[model samples]
Target: MKPFTESMLNQCRKYMFNFFDYLPTKYQASARDWQVRKFVWAFKDGKCAVSAAQLVAKKIREQFGTSASDMVFVCIPASSQRKNEIRYREFSEEVARLSGAVNGYSHITVEGERLAIHESKSGKHVNDVQVINFDKEFFKDKKVLVFDDVITRGYSYARFACHLESFGASVIGGMFLAKTLFV
Candidate 1:
């Protein structure tokens, strides 16, 4: 596993458990790796995501065992425009189902203007307030494991965890398919 930078650790103060970083998005030569791209495509067509989820489940079971039962899996919702193009709910739900965890309620929504940030190299152009909004309910006193396709700067994960905590939910940790070596 890649070590968490001080910035990432700082942003994750609200979480009770260490964030799991499963894969690297690039190699030492700074090229996009096939595994990362294939994992992303798995959300749309390939079966790699299922395998990845199963691996994650195995890891969680080994580390936490029956304690995994209390955790609910949730994804960072894609923007409305992206949702029209690709259904991310399937990716997240499938992970939850395979992991044997409860899929938590999600009310996160993004604005249209923020969609461009996903195409940007660093994903630092978007701020917390401009990117997403959270529902006041749906996660009271629950334990959540937030999942996302990638982690560039970790802004989204930080904000999502904070929002969930504000609603009385305990953010156990976060999971991502890959971690980018970008700002």
Candidate 2:
């Protein structure tokens, strides 16, 4: 079922759009989910960020309609500058090019590495080790769409939205290729 607001956390009332519902690994994912997972792995490996982003861009264009033209799109940053460069930097660029949305990749810069919460055995929050720098004036009164390959729990989107808001940007929504289903 599609929920109107993607962030279950009430504090983050950002609008979010997801293209697919995917079952978690614990459960057998749907065929469509598996297809997306293949691309997600390829994207994470830096092998198909552009191609996969193109598909995402097409979907964004289809779903977002005219509103996308008014918003800037930023990808969720990887663990470090190096990883982000390998993954999302190029991905976001291609998405911007294909989707015709303003590229917000350069607007936010990340320094330092954080523990990968998805891979971690110990508990850690993404913001603890992340240093995100941006020109406050650039985001002032701007609308931003946060893009990610997938959303599991959405802590990242919520925190990132809060961060952008701190700098005066209105995080209008989030866009993800897929959202994981627990069952």
Candidate 3:
């Protein structure tokens, strides 16, 4: 596969930026600036993060041939329910584009009230949000590539991997379009 190009990075940035814009105006500036700086560093590094992930995944596949079971690309949900819904959908679209031509897989949304449940004392009637559901058969013996927009602390990814492993699926790889390497 060709290394990620400036155009690809720019496209990714566009999506990330759009996501940032969806945030409340008060919260968007610092987050946007932070993402820009991260993108600059990642751009200068010339696909180093993505390339490393691809290389590592390829090696693992070569060592242990891929399974017939389908893949599930997992994306973490934002704290805000509205933003989480939007990002989850956008992340699904992006995954479809990035994994083009690959068969035997589908998209699943990970979001609030289902995947990541939070309880607050203020809520006695908090509605449960049903995001997406998958049958166990679909993921059995499958290889999952968890996708996230930016991975800074990595706790989210780690928790996701652990959950998949618990389900008897192999987390063969992880792909992040961008990451915060500096401040």
Candidate 4:
């Protein structure tokens, strides 16, 4: 296991504190307890992240179609330098596992964005992963739920939804494994 940096520890603490404050009084302690459980479980094995992501995805799926065929599962890359966050390969893998278990998806597809920070000839370039391609045919006239490891400010999700919309896909919803307190 990588040593948790002082910065990382501090960030976790700060996030917990904020989450604590966000809860109603009755839920404050319960929320903290759950957070601790999640932290420990998530680090224990890759299953924790995947499990949580699956739950979120499942909820979205339930709302859209009685059948998984009514929806497509699309996720951002688990690792993105532009996001400066931990990579979630295990989480992504788990999501795939859960999706397979449910047995009715029209298809599961991943969203791809260029990693290079491109510099345009005019001196301005987009450097982050932009939703550029999807399984176009599979999603045609299908509802999609976009998944991510976390959502701090919701900008990433917004970008993804917009991209899907542009392509004439109906975005049924978005799901995140965890939402950090700080944007």
The best candidate by lDDT is 2
10 residues in a row with least lDDT, candidate 4: 15-24
Candidate 3: residue 100 Cα off by (Å): 2.8
Backbone clashes, each candidate? 0, 0, 0, 0
Question: What are the C-alpha RMSDs, in order, of all predicted structures?
Answer: 5.8, 4.4, 12.9, 12.2
- Backbone clash pairs for candidate 1 read none
Whole-model Cα lDDT of every candidate shown, in order: 0.61, 0.77, 0.45, 0.47
94-164: candidate 3 lDDT, tens digit per residue: 33344431222233443456333223433556566655344456556766666565554455566555556
The residue ranges of model 2 lying beyond 4 angstroms of the native Cα positions read 1-13, 28-33, 122-128
Considering lDDT, which of the candidate structures 3 and 4 is the better prediction for this target?
4
The sequence of per-residue lDDT tens digits that candidate 2 reaches over residues 1-183 is 324244336424557777777665667767877887776777777889878787878877887887778888888787788888888888888888888888888877889988865566456445557787776787788888888777877877777777777787878778887887776
lDDT of the structure predicted as candidate 4: 0.47
**Which is better, 2 or 4, measured by lDDT?**
2
- Residue pairs in collision within model 3: none
**Least lDDT summed over 10 consecutive residues: which range in candidate 1?**
14-23
lDDT of 4 at 52: 62
TM-score of candidate 1 relative to the true fold? 0.66
